[model samples]
Target: MPKLKVLNLFRIQLSLLPSSLGHLINLQTLCLDYSKIEDFAIIGKLKRLKVLSLQHSDIKELTTEISQLTQLRLLDLSNCGRLEVIAPNVISKLSQLEDLYVQLCPIQWNVEVLEELKGLSKLTRLELDIKDSKMLPQGFFSKELRRYNISIGDWPARINGDESLRTLQFKVNSTISLEEFQGIKNVEFLLFANVENGLDELQSNITPLFNEKV
Candidate 1:
């Protein structure tokens, strides 16, 4: 398996990878989505890895060594409700990160939780479970990130409608009026979650009703 560069264990029984997996020096993509893996520390040795998808796994914590993969571009942790922690500055360490998806993360719920994202200057897409909209630091959304998904617990005063945004998902837990989305436009995919408004009323506020997603 010296030439093996891609590994896709969609649903394997192997919960933990052997430390010798580091020998895959040329490996570039690793897909471990929907596995029972509880730990993810050995894969960091893949210096050439560019894509890693660990969506919907039992992984509760990531080792500090995860930040060592500076070449990583995409990391999907969606539906990982049990994921509890990421080493401080772990996100910031992935200098080449472009698409970062973190949904329902049960880790620290504070203002600084989003602070690590600011350092990923190359980010192009971001999905976050925003528990406290007020805690969001200034410029939490980068103009460079064309795709965004944010679940807000509280109504935010200002939401950036970047002209470059290709997809925007505004998941509000509060019963806010849909009229607030009148400013959003020209997005390929737009989603509204948990809005306590009727379909007719919700459509009246948003101009492009045809582009609604979920």
Candidate 2:
């Protein structure tokens, strides 16, 4: 298996990737979605790896070695509910990262983390889970966002639209109106959570937001 370039361990029930996996210098894609991987210390040793998927994993931390994957283009960590901390400056080192998905994780972000995001010059698509909605005006949401899962206390005044935007989710706390979303009309998937009103009432409010656009 020295020449194996792709490894698919999706739901394989493995808790950790073999340190030997680092030996796969030619490996380009590694899929460990829904696996039990809690240790990825040697993952970055695969310097040529391009795509890594750890979706729904119980990942608690990422090693500093992850920064070695200079070719990394996509990192999927969606549904990682137990994830809490990430080694500082690890994300900022992936200068080639194009798409990063990190939804439903409870990691607390600091100023350095925010600064790292601002320096990702090649980032194009992002899926994030934020604790504050006010960060919108601070230049957090990008015009390049295509699919977003956001949980915030307030609705953004405006969502910059991109023809590529397809899935839009809002986990808000207050009443949201269609007028705030008039700029976006091409959304194919829409959702609302944690609103002040009941689900049915919330649906009624957003119906016009989507129906009129359709």
Candidate 3:
């Protein structure tokens, strides 16, 4: 079992990982999706781990220990409603990470957390949700990202778009200037929800196929 490369403990009704799991030095993929296990400290021992999925799990926080998996390429924390904290510099430590999914999670996003994402030089795909559109900093996302689904408000955003295109959706509650955001310049699909009168003010060279004004 020391040479195990994949472990699918998905939906397992366990509280903790077995101590022997640390012996799987060669493990590359571990899926705990929809599981009740919360303690992930043992996962840090898997130096070769490349993929980790905690979707719909009961984990409350992403502790510093998990950042030891420097080889991680894909991490899925989507639908982790209980997830609250992600230790500082933990995300930047995943130097090899290429894809990250945090959609539908209840974690509070701040400027510090958003800034940390910029350090992932290898990231190409991302799915994220920010509760307030005003919190977005100028030049938010990296220009190198090929595909993304980002929702910046409480409204339900349109998800239909070309898979090759980057999508950015946000709710406009007050008068605001969109041109200041350099990250939106490359966005192929954009949604401006609840914009009342000034649709022309937000227009740019990039025209969005979806725009809902009320």
Give the winner by lDDT: 3
How many clashes (backbone atoms < 3 Å, residues ≥3 apart in a chain or on different chains) does model 3 have? 0
TM-score of 3: 0.85
Poorly placed runs, candidate 1 (over 4 Å):
154-214
CA shift at 83, candidate 3, in angstroms?
A: 1.3
lDDT of each: 0.71, 0.71, 0.80
| Candidate 1 CA-lDDT value | 0.71
Residue 62 displacement in candidate 3 (angstroms)? 1.1
Q: Could you estimate the TM-score for every candidate?
A: 0.72, 0.69, 0.85
Better of 1 and 3 by lDDT: 3
Summarize candidate 3's per-residue lDDT along 1-214 as a digit string, tens digits: 6778999998999989898999999999999999998888999999999999999999999989888999999999999989977887789799999999988887776767677787788998998888766666556753567788888877653465677877877776552444434345467777767655566644542244224121
How many clashes (backbone N, Cα, C below 3 Å) per candidate? 0, 0, 0
Candidate 2, residues 87-195: lDDT per residue as tens digits? Answer: 7889989999888887677776554575577578888677766655433334444344445444444344323335455566666544334455554544566656666
Query: Can you write out model 1's per-residue Cα lDDT over 142-166, one digit (the tens) per residue?
Result: 3445677655553343244454556
Which ranges of candidate 3 are over 4 A from the true structure? 156-162, 173-179, 196-214
